[model samples]
Target: MATGLLTSEQAEQIVTTCRTAIGDSLRSVTYFTRDDYEQVYLRNDLERDADLSTFIGHEWRGFKTAQTAYEGSELGDYNYTIRVFDNGFLIRVTNESEGVFATTDGLTVKDFEEVATALNSFLGDREVR
Candidate 1:
């Protein structure tokens, strides 16, 4: 028997969508500027004892990996880190599992908005159990 799996493009689309949704919320809560790629960093400011997963959601496993290419630390029950890129954006999100991490290159603010809107629409149209 064969199981269904998401294609790379599909997976990327999902990640982009999720990021946009979170990004919009972040923007409303803070002030920041975007670089040439329209990328902005969202920092985590929760108390040390707070649950990180509540902020980043359950899908954080995608960015966390065993390779240790990036340095990370644990705060309470969650592992967290700062994601800094050459594009001048520094996002601090929780890292708990390993999956997929999207690159800031080739992604614009407009694209991020579109992805977020699409994800919101998709979820709204679906039935969650």
Candidate 2:
């Protein structure tokens, strides 16, 4: 039962797909549309009361600007963003309708590439539905 745009099964699939790419290093998965968001999964080691509004706002505003920011540039096109922190990484994947952000422990460059590819494929397919 989804409290938002994504179904429970779809949420599970997102987690499964990401975990397959990044393993237990993946910490949490949150789904967000333009107006709302939901934490579909969180690791047991983590706290429940995170303030996700900041990330949600970034995804809404930043991604929109990002898509247009690179238009006609040699950089080609906009893909995802990986924000690195001291102890973790924040991976953001978005399409026009919605997006998902995943927090993770340490990961290799290949792991980042694979997870980005996996998430983009998943979210891209969802936009058609």
Candidate 3:
């Protein structure tokens, strides 16, 4: 349970919990898995103009393992992408959209932080894989 080392099932549960914590702010959350990524949460109806998405992927490059959360959406009219990697994370805001922003802006920084914090806290308590 190292930082960003969530299994596919654990990632799904975390995403689901985070989505529930956000409550009615999101219209819906779709969960699925992909080839490279273990799980993904597609959050719709974030605000009046954007939807948020979170995806988890893990891989071992030689002896080092990398687990990360690839999150993207709009905090307001401006779009943002947050990449949460093991041990550290980064957030970037942008004015240009890759056409992923929806039509609302209800998702707030506080809300996002709450979810991220919860995930980080969960990871902090477990042994590193």
Best by TM-score: 2
Evaluate all candidate structures by whole-model CA lDDT and list the values in order: 0.34, 0.85, 0.36
lDDT of 3 by residue, 1-129 (tens): 123435667666655655655665533332222222222343452332322223222111210211122223333322234444453333321111111111112556676666545544544444434
lDDT for model 2 comes to 0.85
Better of 1 and 3 by TM-score: 3
| Model 2 stretches with alpha carbons more than 4 Å out | 127-129
Q: Model 1: clashing residue pairs?
A: 61-97, 61-98, 62-99
- What lDDT is obtained when candidate 3 is compared to the true structure? 0.36
Per-prediction TM-score, please?
Answer: 0.27, 0.91, 0.35
Candidate 2, 8-41: lDDT as tens digits: 7788889998899989998989888887888887
